[model samples]
Target: MITDRHYEIIVYGATPGGIGAAVAAARRGRRTLLLEPSPYIGGMMTSGLGRTDIDWLDASGAIYREFAHRVEAHYTAQYGTASPEAEACNRGMFFEPSVARAILEDMLAAESRLTLVRRSELLSAEAVDGRLTAIAIETEAGEGEWQGRSALSADVFIDGTYEGDLAAMAGVPYEVGRESRDEWNEEYAGVLYMNFGPSKEVLPGSTGEGDDRIQAYNYRLCLTDVPENRVAPGKPASYNREEYASLSVDAAEGRVRSIRDVLNILPVPGGKTDTNNHHYCMCSSDLPEENGTYLEGGREERQRVRDRHRHYYQGLLWFLQHDESLPEAFREDAQRWGYAADEFADTDNFPPQLYVREGRRILGEYRFTENDARLAPGLGRSPIHADSVAVGAYAIDSHATRKREAAGRNVALEGFLGLGWLTEVYQIPYGVMVPLGVDGLLVPVAVSATHMGLGTIRMEPCWMQLGYAAGVAADLAIAGGAAPRDIPIDNLQDELLAADQLIGFYRDIDASGLMGKAIQYFGAKGAFRSYEARPDEPLTVERASALLALARLLPGGSRFPALPAAGAVLPAGADMGPRLPREEPSPAAYWQRHPLLTQGLAGRWLQAAGRALSAGTAGAAGGSVSASAAARASSPAAAWLRTDSAAAAEGGPSASGGAGEAAPAVSVGEWCALLYGLLLEARRAGSSGSGGR
Candidate 1:
């Protein structure tokens, strides 16, 4: 290992996030140091956890997308485009573990400014006055001893390790395990899963209580059904038959239905499989009891714990495949699948990285809680963060931590945290990446979040997105000669967008689609600011009408108003808030009465309105317009009444309540269209209706 090298950005833990950060930083011309404790570079992705669980819609960053596309391209190049491997590649969600590793390495190799050091551990971190100065690293010498020691200084440090080792060593304040519900007002926080099964024994902390226990850890097994790539199961060095005593009994009594009942064997490209533990299965490698201590353990201690887990899981696999007491069919099926000989060639086809679901999470500037992960109370989506750095779309899914018996059935607590039934997309703010009161440090992995909150943002894609953001933030900080927290968020957002990092979900509307021009038009008129517009969510009648009123006020052919920042924050009760005119009480009732005011009628109404405005006609059918309507319309409100009469005369549905027609809901895209139509008519008439509603 080279000891004389100094880097502009020092990244620890070569996980997916670390790779992303190192690449991003190096691309920006900053000399970067990427250090991995293990010999492998790709952490989980290379370590048999290849069945990616990603929310493709929210994965908008360039780096992550590029990585995904490369994986797809890899499969397509190796296998025919019409092959099953190509199909999985076309989907771009899952791939073989080795393929992912190769893609990451290729990307890393392209960067001239990156230095990769493997099998090096973080021995100590020197921080002065809440600012990290230097980090001491110990490179592995011959045998298990680390005789080579070196220290490096960097302008910025990024902790991309799943375990948060660098951040913990830097003296960043962090937490382990769940927090009480009261702490963050999180519904899934603290002790959960108390009454899930037959166990009467309460966790030391009662239900909904806080503790240091973290989610379970496991090795993602890369197996293969094809005999060509299969390596038969072998007895681990530390395996003990007694360790799987309960499993043997359970199998004999027919408690275990099938090997799949407890194992998640998801297929990847090239006939490989990414296998994980199932909730009801007795084959889990999760060592929940040792997790708390492991989280705080040193390298040696952690290695021992990892070894024990390996023995426990391997022993269980051996029992399932060879034990005579188990059902014959189950054993046969288990024997059909074996380790993929082509993958993880260095580790005898076993994954090198362990799945550390949760570790020491920094209590950063903003602690993202479960409340933030859930849908906004009144809105059907999540809130927009003014300082968002990335977008995350996934459910808060946490695995069980401790297993116990309840009512003669096995139960697990703090294992599965289902924060919400629906998978909602949310913004990850920049504040959470900045540890509280820390300087020159950014934590993209194991960020400042509650255990439940981490569940949603813990996916590999999300981590890579955060890593990209960190790299940009570091670049900006260095250029401005300022600390991370001191950099203006607006400027940072500018840089993020330049790097193709998605910061917010809003304004992600298609720029080339039908709504593109309309969104640009209304966006200029400041009409969308009335509410946090989820351009993706279905538009309610209330929002549709409000958008119309705002559009009518803008003069036809007038320049679009200056657009606000995508996620700009405004004081509560600001005039710019969605000032949608309040409808008569029972807004739903009014819509029911005038079904034509809903979605399906928007096109017809626009046509009629255009004709009425063109002819300068008013007072058709002699119905008087309401005073409020007259005050708001630049042209006579009688024109609207005439348009309604014209529609009625044309054998179309009348605006004054159709003949019991159903009110069709409008989507945000549809609302944009209607708004566009209205703007066009006003422009043709050369009139502008100005002022707030």
Candidate 2:
């Protein structure tokens, strides 16, 4: 009783990445179909994860930024202000899961070219001539088949599933687990068994215990704090707290203090907070172990694992909320948050899907590695020819693969470490999205890459950007009659650059001008008026509204539309860009007046600043080394100079000028010379290349 549907492009998975891919493909004028196993979309954002782990917010593409802007818009419309925390108890850029779902649905509804199918699961794929030709799917209503599902048949197939299920089903080779140190010559690879400092001897994989292995997995409960809007935590049918007894015991033993220990709390509008459990300890919910077996697991097994996580998290919540052993303060806080009354009315307020942190990483023509994470010399020279999609800047963060004792204590070494370079972001090569041996397959979520590289690239914003890029690539392939991997890099870059995506560190006037315009647009839309934007700046709640009004998220005409009339003191000309000294124009103004000129100036300033900081830090470290070397004519001074010189060569400011002061205007040719110089240096340093092959 089911019918088959055909489309120019089909995107698997309805997660954020999937949504982005679908939108991109559709925007590109391609007939795109999005298939989701669940009835709702927005994956984690609409599921239980009201919180978002976004790195390099500045580097995110237009699509992702617009999504965030929409979230802001929704809250503003609902509350007459964007402060979700003040109106709700959760407090922190978090929202009810239902809100996210509605927004996503609306987004798709507005798009005529995109068709969404829910409760549909991909069963198998048909291949011809080593290319995927069709995909067979089973739905609740019946069964259907899709032709051109492969690299050759369909111009491109984007695997946007959280688990990379489609990519694995396609028989693409991938990897899971920490590679040994020898594998990539990385300093922090394989099972680290050493403890650097004070720690606890909980279990090896126990969250926050500093175990030398990855942490276990658990659910991120989206609870409410408002009594009127809160729903009590419900026990899953297969609940088993005993399975987590060891962790509970660890809590009692002072090994694990609170379940919120590792929670990455993101503040949404109002008082609601979105809690994400992706780090070590606490609800260490990223299952590196289970990820490897995902490809082999049957539907039942997958559900079982999902059920176990739900039970575990529910029990943990129950324990914290009512357990007599819990501290009074902890219990009080735990009781304040429960499921929102108006959100996720089904499944007892739990997210329908688990957040899949890692999946089947395709071993394509190139592989991104720790070296890339380090931004090693010459890493980006023979860049993947695909259009540079998005940019990422988080440090390589991987959880422990297995529990192990280090220095007589159980500790999890898997955690975040900042990449030393500042204002330096990594470009996601187009090739990373193309699957090798799969002619039409394009992977945005679990693209071909190394585990280390994924640590930074796995963030939500980055994934969204990647999804956007992949969608564009797919459309190009479909229109040009070429494999995704075969698309010329120049063409891709041109298109991507036009789309305002940040590719490499080097920026041209055009790209910079576009970004400036975007910043202005966002400001006008009132998207940048969050209290977090200037956390260090002192401002009262009333002032906060004033600042937000500048971003146009607030009612520009009314003074504090949501606030009391007495408190709503509308500033004169509040609609104008942020107030600045007469001598110093706003960033928006600077960019607007001389789009390219401003971009060149800013780029030069940033590069100069980077060089200055590097020189200073290296100089300090070299002083001590210099003394020792002086004794033997091997002054660390020389080493320091070399390091500083190398950093300077890599786009750091020249030795002569301060980073803040604007340099004299240079001709376009001169600017290109400077950029070319840096590009060449990057190549010589081996920092530029198409990722691993």
Candidate 3:
């Protein structure tokens, strides 16, 4: 039997990006429907990704910020501080998967307009003249048809599934596998061969001749150290380690270990550790043979892959926990963390979905390439319109495509490449989210754009921001009676900027209003403020902490205080002294010449301030100015003093100011003096800022 329901918007996947998109759509007062093939809401976060590989937290938008806040709230309520390690292990922001699931579900429930259907699969979709007309879904109860899935028959449909299944089914053209350099004229697009092992031994089956070979995929496993909560490795019904026997043997022989071996273990406060599961094309458990086939495979074949992953992860666990071949210290450390009691109970201890790093990326009208990333020095202008949605920072990290052993050694290309550590953050245009010819459908994840582009945009926060943008575009399409791709760039830009989405890093700012609040928050906390905030620039560890401190979100108060007056200048022979090349310009000098960098700095400072204010400082008065003026004012020296004065003046509770007024000017020295006064005022007012003291 088939039943029918109507909704203004339909979001598939239930991944973090899906949840964000659904919430965004619902919040816009759309009659939204969120369908999850799995039982839980958070696809990765709540599955087993306790340790996050967040690339650009500085550029993460409100949707992601809300998610982070919930995580902080969970810890604060339980441990009185955001640092979980303070209560137990040295855990930072890691959380139990179940807790993340609960938070996402709770957030969904709070929105009365959103409908959540769990264990529901999108069987098929019907479109008319480029617009999605209806979708047929299968659930436990029975099959059902959803009509007007978006406003006016889904004015815009967002594909949030990690696998890009919906987009593929909808007849959208998408690309799978890496593109050869010849195709995109990109330096980093083709197959790369690198030596990852300690020695320079060349192993056969390790080198690749082409880029057709795809990277391996794996299930992110959640492990724990507690014996009572520990679950032993279980063999999959279709257990067959023979296929992987060679790799296992090599790993045992210390020739090749799973990426897990190099995992950067993030310790939780309570003695637990969050292990990151990274994948490379040639590494252990990457399952290269399983690429592209996941969506097309029959249920049995799919289950087989799942079984293989289970066995692989199980074998991995056994090796980590009890393998005598491993060093004693390694074995002991591996046994410290096990599955959390409250998470993924049904799977015995595994996430439901395998982390699909890349899927069928939609072949949208405009394909972003490395050229777009490195935009030629003097291209007339970018085909990428001004409507940008998200920012990306991760390197172009493509894994090996084949396995080989040669010259009595096994070698693979598994390390990161492209735009090394010093690469600037890249802006993702709204066009990447819009599909060509497909009127209603928009892909926020695993859709459209080049393979190299995916390297940076694959992070969770970036995905969430893209999802948010998709939702807003859907709303605009519904209200204005236009297709997603046809939603004028000007209108899209206005809405995105209004919503606080950082687009282009250069064009938007309400700096005085928000930047001041940020300065005040961090200044009062005695935290080191980055002399300048540039959105397009990659965030260094130092700057990240500074921003966190400014937002009052850092676990502890300022880690670095203002340098003593006498020691402010670089010491003679100091390696840390300014190391800019003689012919090259400093960041300050570059900002002066590049309006984009200037705008980026203004927007970032304002964004930092906005976060600080929203975290709970009262408003500071200031009038609006053109982004140009804000950009000009963000020069290093001026920016520092401006931020310093603002931070000093409103460092306390009950700060308020109306638009356009200068408020009150406090000199840098006077600002420092006011810090003590601000502390007293905050204490008296019982403000949250007092918590830092």
Candidate 4:
């Protein structure tokens, strides 16, 4: 086995996020080493978890888009582009496991500086003076280049495992289970049960108290009903009828209707479904408390854990299909499913990886909570995250952590939270990935977040985006000979922007353009609040004044002049904000139903504002815009997802930083862009928001 070599970056795990980190670092001219414990590389993506867990593909940035494109292209090339097969691909969001693996393999092949070693598991790690120094891994016997015990040393390391194995081995402070509600002030913290439907309502017996119990784990099975290719599942090697007794009861009660109710059988291309455990079911594929043993267990014990789940699920399926105790109708429905003949061909058509929903979450520089994903009481969007490295849009979803002790009763299982209630597209800060005293390592998949916080951040696409940022950050850190937290934020941000990765979310401006850059910068500086359609409807005089004022980082805020008693829009001569007319060359605030402030006047004010703000200190990305991202500001979350979802865009109230601010001449988008461009222009012209002399 190749060993005893020093590397620039060593990333453990072959998950999509790991690939993102390794490739990003390699592309930036770092010698990167990628190690995978299993023979597989794509983690759940190529391990039967087929339906993509993301909402907005456009905002997912480059690496995710590339993977999506390749998956779609694979089928489109075989079937005509307009064919149903191609349509079913959903741009690779719906895909076959093997195809995903092949595509990812190809992605890695293109990077010459990258080296990937599979079947390699980390055994031990060494950290000195708070910096990770070396790690020992044992690659299983294989023909592939590296095998057996090997020691690797790297300047930077990333714990990309679904379980924070490397982080734990390196003495990173990690916690297993949910935190108390009061600890992080998370609403869904601790033991809870909820009924998920049109609305998620918490059930009785839900205590806000914390526990060590974590969300359940299950394998995402790829099953198909295709006649010619279907392989009927035989009984598991260690099938136990009593283990599946609860399933039969659930079926009798109609809670388990068909195989569909028992599993989240989402359709993928080629007539197969990326089948996963259904949380709402009282008894299904999920064996809640069993996963805790696996999380804290060693490799051999974990393998046993994997085996137990596979056997339990297979036994349940067998019982549902054959037991006379179940209704014949239910049996017939269950009989329609069989292992997809094409997938997991080697493992008897079963997925190899156990879906470890969550693992060890390290204590980070920042511990994001459920509130971070909620709207700020007064702002238009989630609280502004100036240090954001990526964005998470999924709701705070967690599966049951424990089965009901009394199976016959209708009591909902504890710890099943499918609630998307008031969930917002929130930004993930760089602090979360940087463990509090640990240097030279970044944790992406098993990130630093509250259990509820993981609800939003625990999706593959989000991890890849964060991993991509970590990879770039590693490059910059190495170049500057500094820790990840100490590196220049602007340089890291610039690289991410250049790579088309989003650090900030804006609805109206195309993120690839210069306007997007301005919007992000100003938005981070406390300018824009909501993610609603670009505040394109002419800048209200009130909003314009607030934008300039916010950029200046003034302490107090001004309320909008009260609206006319009975008009649809503000009156032309309405008061805007404090002492605007007293400023040098300040034009009389016009009272237009639209565009109260034109671009010409905005440019003049911005020049003076920039010189003033910059002269004191460059707007700090080190902290939140005005309210810290941690602040429990109960601001009204503006409808940021409106542009992404038609239903959202059509509803919700967004206070555009001021009470009286609404439509009025330059678009807020245009103004931000114009203002930023002028700032850059002024910086270049050797000058700066004079209210136009």
Candidate 5:
């Protein structure tokens, strides 16, 4: 029976961002309705792309880290950490697709405030006076489309679907294709391809102004070479020998060698590989002129497109492995690989979700353009943002927008664009998550960004981060009885900071452990007033000194005394503790920039602070700190720091010679823990030695 339902928060789609939004909102005491079209929850992670594409770990925020830790625990519990399975899982960096799905399912089931409905799709949405009021959903009843439909009213809504269906139904403006270069002043925008390159030659319509050309979509296949756990590729229902005519020609001419050569086979847990298309159209899986149509079409149409892709790709796989028309060597090499036995058993070893590379992007209030992604002349970093809700470090990565043939050469266009590695992490503004002139709705997955800009922000981590932020924003708005856009940004930042969300990288604190409070404390004292440290980027001497001064300053007191009058430097051949590994190299060149905080200097300063505090001259511990303060700086939270410090003190790189390693830069979190931990330890020692002094 279809019935009208009311929810405080309605999250459409079970994409990672949607799951994140739903979990966050429910955890915050709001009634959340999480709807998904499929039976499974995880999108691609549960489908086949098990290896996470996370680059900037610090930028992923608290929830993501929490999820990662849980995955690690799962492995440790089941496989004893040292087992090959656990090692292959790599602590959530790689895992089985089913494992990813199971985790998401557990998360959903554990949340009491979240109501999840699988096999339900959002049909339409209603918005009045710029605020979305309610939405309609079509549920599956047995095996028929006539399943009763239902209406849902919610205070806030999130469109986390890759297709952006809810946002479209709500009448929010969106773009479906690449923008013209002049439209957003993005150099990589518009139709970009080489006129004479082997992959993308001067084909008709090869390089033209922007059109409704969406990037190619593919299923992230999980395959294994192990005969026991592998299923041989068989002929699809729509198999055609004609499809291999062109490919066979390329193979006979030596342009194509073994099928494995044109496939991206990334190793995952249990010896399985996440396979996808490589160069020269081996598994590009892109269908031109159909993607745009599917974006605008209904769920049924989208399903058809997805099915067509599966059939075509499956047929291509069968042809490569079975067809005798191809070279015997290539065919035999292809025979070694087959579908993973443990993945997607429900779909006959095929992935459930289609890897929709590009889709409807919300025309957000503040559109992120390529200019926001531009590298600083020689530096590989982009400009920073004050209103950053999340950070993304991945370069602009886009697959092929279109494929064609020109001058008897197969050509793919506008496929790959990258800045390789960034000099600094880029900030994604909060405004990008809000659709322009739309209220009570946050489009985290299909966020507002130019085609070129979306290249970096479209990753799963960025989406999940944005979705988590959206959930917080929704909760804040509900509590304040105000629109999401009307909430004071300062208050938002405060709330985000309280939850350990990465709004900005102040004092080298990326919201890891109890670092936020420490960073915020030093930030409040103007120690890091002018500095914005990059993710994992080392701190300079001046920056480190500034932070240390703040830590040493007595609360309620004004002035900071100068550094302990130039401590004696250790001369060559001096006995420096045990030998350790080389120091890690800092991101920037030391001579070109300021002096870095070496491990030796950091240890010496820590030892000096401890000595000074024990002598009763350093500073006072004030009235009281937060009850959770100790836990925040507890050893477990700061274990990595201690390990590094121990290594450094033991004639490590800072003491001995370790060339081209990372210079020991004290993180804001580490410095805070060190300062507090040392003071506490020294106080204990002082009290033990004193006889009622």
Candidate 6:
């Protein structure tokens, strides 16, 4: 029997990114459906990966930040605000798998427009004229529309699954594994062996040649020491003592002192820790070369790989706990920990999800490379994306893709790289989400990126940001009756900014504020002197006027509409000329005019504009004029109104300030911020057409 259902957006996978996409779409008032192959949600965050991969909180966009806030609130609500549970919540980034799952479930339940189908699998999909019109799904459980074969039709389909299953089924081209170093001129491309790196050292036999090998996959188990909530590891049917003979040696040699030495066990709330492979450990959960075909394989092959991982991990745990070959002290430490009884209660107390680090990445509009995330040459930041919808600061590192000789060197772990090196704040362009040839589809999870590029983009925080963007973009597409790729970037960005999502990075300021937004807005347009937007520096009122004038020209653009005669939509990678109003310079033209953001000359346009803003808002007695002191500047014209409105929003100068009393010292940052805020408010006032205010 077949069933039919219609929704504005359909997202598959129920991973963190899937949940993010579904929830954002629904919250934006679009009817949405989220399908999970498993009966669970929140993927790793709710499974075994309780630790969120985020360091700088500002880089985290709105959705992840909201999840973090709610997770903390959950603990505080259950156990008082000052309780140990609340304190251990680590601002919601630290939580048990169960807590994470429950929190996400609650979040999904609160969204009335979203319908989540559990244990659903994608059977096939249909497309016409390069547009996906519908997809077929089969749910093994539940009842009625929730069970059996069904056809789902939507305006837009977002593939949020870790494996890019939806996009693949829709016939979007994809790449798996590493690319040649020369392919994208990426330094970390292909087989890698890091000896030690203050700088990256390529070992002998290390080749930048392309290969199909990808980083290893493993389950991040949630283990607890609580007597009442502990399920001891047992011997798996596939356990072979010969496979773990090396672990015994490590324990005797002090390389493996306890379970902690082999597995990275991080403390979360509720007396449990999320455990995963330790990169430099003697032995780890990661099994290299075992997962090579999992990406392109059928359901059975994929499940076989997952089962292999389960047996390998379970056997290792049992070996650590019960094997007499290791010292009693080491065994005792391993014995203290077991799968948390309250977590993953189904499926034999084991995490049901396998953390697929790298999957089938769509060969989409733009293939992001390491260069996209690295600080370019002398610049302090990464490449500034014109259509930036999200920001990421995580290091571009991956786990072992190929293990070394069984006895050789753990340091010889091919493809193993560390964090905190060669990564700066980078912006992810919307093009990554737009798959080539597929109009109604967006692949936010398995995005278009080289293996090295996926190193950072693969993080849950970054994927969630992309997922959230795709959600908003999908709704915008529906509203305009346009394809996902044709959604106007300015509209998407405006929505992101309103929700306090980080489209651009600021070191000393908050993007949600007008000052931060203004600077980031222009920065995205390549208006900053360099890539940096140092918004806190003082500026003259003379400079501020020019920038406010400049801000006026940066307006929303029309979607690169299809040509009427040809009647063909621009393919995903087509160069959409000039992402700015006709009045503004192209990014190249602007780049040549300004170059890098220099610190000298009022700062040089954050130098030219910063100088201009500082001169206009807070200049020297002869040159600059703050809001209170601007007698010459204080005519009740639009300039005064603009500055006044900015000042009011910033809580700096009073609304009733008379002409030229005594202008306070205004920073160039403040002036830009104030002007930007006024500009934003005026823009949002929507097609009133800047009534001269």
The 10-residue segment with the lowest total lDDT in model 4: 628-637
Per-residue CA lDDT of model 5 for 420-523, tens digit only, reads 44324566778888898789999989988877788878777778778888888889889879887766454455456567766545544435544554454334
Best by the TM-score measure:
6
lDDT of 6 by residue, 38-130 (tens): 888888888788888877666786899898898889999999899999998888878888888888899899999999999999999999999
C-alpha positional error of residue 8 in candidate 1 after TM-score superposition, expressed in Å = 1.6
lDDT of each: 0.69, 0.55, 0.55, 0.73, 0.67, 0.75
lDDT by residue (392-462, candidate 1, tens digit) is: 87777777776544522444444554544545667788888899867999999979999878988898888
Across residues 271-370, which tens digit of lDDT does each residue of candidate 3 receive? 4445554332233445555555665675577677776766766665555556565566666676665665545789776778777777777888668776
Per-residue C-alpha lDDT of model 4 across residues 572-600, encoded as one tens digit per residue = 35453453434523122224433365332
Model 5 lowest lDDT segment of ten: 684-693
- Ranking the candidates on lDDT from highest down gives 6, 4, 1, 5, 3, 2
> Clash number for every model?
14, 66, 45, 19, 10, 29
What local lDDT score does residue 262 receive in model 3, on the 0 to 100 scale?
42
Identify the leading candidate in terms of lDDT. 6
The residue-by-residue lDDT of candidate 2 on 1-693, one tens digit each, is: 233545788898988888888998898889888888777787777776665655434545556667766776776666666353334412223455666678778888888899787777888776567676667776655323322232212546788886777877777777755566566665555544323223322224222222223323445556556688778776556655554445555566676666565344555544455666534452344433443444457888878778766766676667666766656776677677777666666776677777666666777776776665564344322122223456666766555454322432444443422333321355577777777776778888887666667767877667877888888878877776887877645445435545766555332222344333222222222323221222122223334334324322211111112322121112244353453445555544543433222222323222332332233455544442332222113211122122232232332222222352242232332222222223223323333333211
In candidate 3, what residue range of length 10 has the lowest lDDT sum? 652-661
lDDT of model 4, residue 372:
87
Candidate 6 or 5, higher TM-score:
6
Candidate 6 — which residues are off by over 4 angstroms? Answer: 195-202, 406-408, 529-532, 540-553, 556-666, 674-693
Instruction: List all candidate RMSDs to the true structure.
Output: 11.6, 18.7, 14.7, 10.2, 11.3, 11.5
